[model samples]
Target: MSVSHLIKHSAITTGILSLASFGLAASPSQAVSVDFSSWDKLGDVYTQPGEASLSNDNANFQDDSPQASGYYNLSGNNPEEASPNPNLQDFLGLDAESLDDDGQAYEGSAIKSVITAQAGDKLSFEWRFSTNETSNKDFGFFLVNNNVIKLADFTNALQSGTSGSFQTNTGFNTFSYTFNSAGTYNLGFGVVDVGDYVTSSALDVKNGNLEEVPEPTTIVGSLILVSAGLLERSRKKARK
Candidate 1:
């Protein structure tokens, strides 16, 4: 190959490499569409009409301020009125027979939302669990497609505060999940009264997000095609 042709080929390869580097370094992450108003109630009774709420203020647990938050509670005026939630039981891997009297009746409240994500996409959010229950059985948890991912047991909570009659934990914990395949998923958060339904427990969730991740193989494949096209052009010019 002539000197000029070699120079052109080198320039093309250099430009392609630079573009690939930039793309890998600065790939933009997209904002996930979370409809705060579209969250569906998952459990049976909510204690009161407004026990579950959507808001931007940090009034619930005095934790981090969020763009928007969905809160669910297991406390109310009447503790006996609280009923066992079958869906929550399913998520916890417990059966109706296991949640009988003898101070083991489990009641819970939760909110769920449907979201679409691509393979390798990441979903993340901040959650806080607050309760006045002295028993360690009462806890907070999250679910993906009705399957429990993590349980925030009362014994694990290191922080403590007060929110009305209930003792609160003002610390917010972050949770993240990466989808293995592209599809729609149901994401949910809730608080459960494990032993008895006397004391109230609440869950606060905020800043829900999903980020699209670019595959490295895809980027490499495009670079290979560009390199091939540029080399072909260089060969044709050399022939001339």
Candidate 2:
């Protein structure tokens, strides 16, 4: 082949290769679908009308660092309805009768959503737990299919600056869980005033996501096949 023909063929090959690489690199990964609209107040948890909120503003809670898009807030306060959720009390291992006898109330605010996920799917979220009751056993919690997971408690949380009415706060933390079996799950986030209802506690959650684990071997194999086909087509065009 002449030098000019060699240069033209080489340029075409380089261009096609670059395009193939870009296509593979720029491909979006699969994300598990989360129905944000499905979020609703958990069973009969005691809360005022404005206690549960979904908003984009984190500054309202004095969080200097905000998260992407929006966040869910569940704040517990003095029982407005006095109707504590038995399910939540059971989850917390609190005796409702004993609490009532002691003049203490178990007030909670929680939001729950039903999600369908496959095995190996990972769910994650960023959360901050804040509270005003330093002496009481206020806490923040997360649940997967009724299995309670404690996020933070009054004793464990750091003495950071106030969050809304809460005098103490815990900085943003991350929680992630991988599904072990393919099925539907109930996801929950909440805060509760354990010993006293006089003070309040809040849980803030943002960037909730469920994502499918990528199979590197399969993805790489498919990309290779696609690149090979592209290269073959380019070779045929160059010949013409």
Could you say which candidate leads in TM-score? 1
Q: Which stretches of candidate 1 lie over 4 Å from their true place?
A: 1-4, 7-27, 42-105, 163-165, 215-240
Tens digits of per-residue lDDT for model 2 on 158-186?
A: 86754434457788888899999889887
Give the lDDT of residue 38 in candidate 1.
53
CA lDDT of every candidate: 0.57, 0.56
Candidate 2 off by > 4 Å: 1-28, 32-38, 42-105, 162-164, 215-240
Q: TM-score each candidate.
A: 0.61, 0.57
Ten residues in sequence with the least summed lDDT for candidate 1? 54-63
Show pairs that collide, candidate 1: none
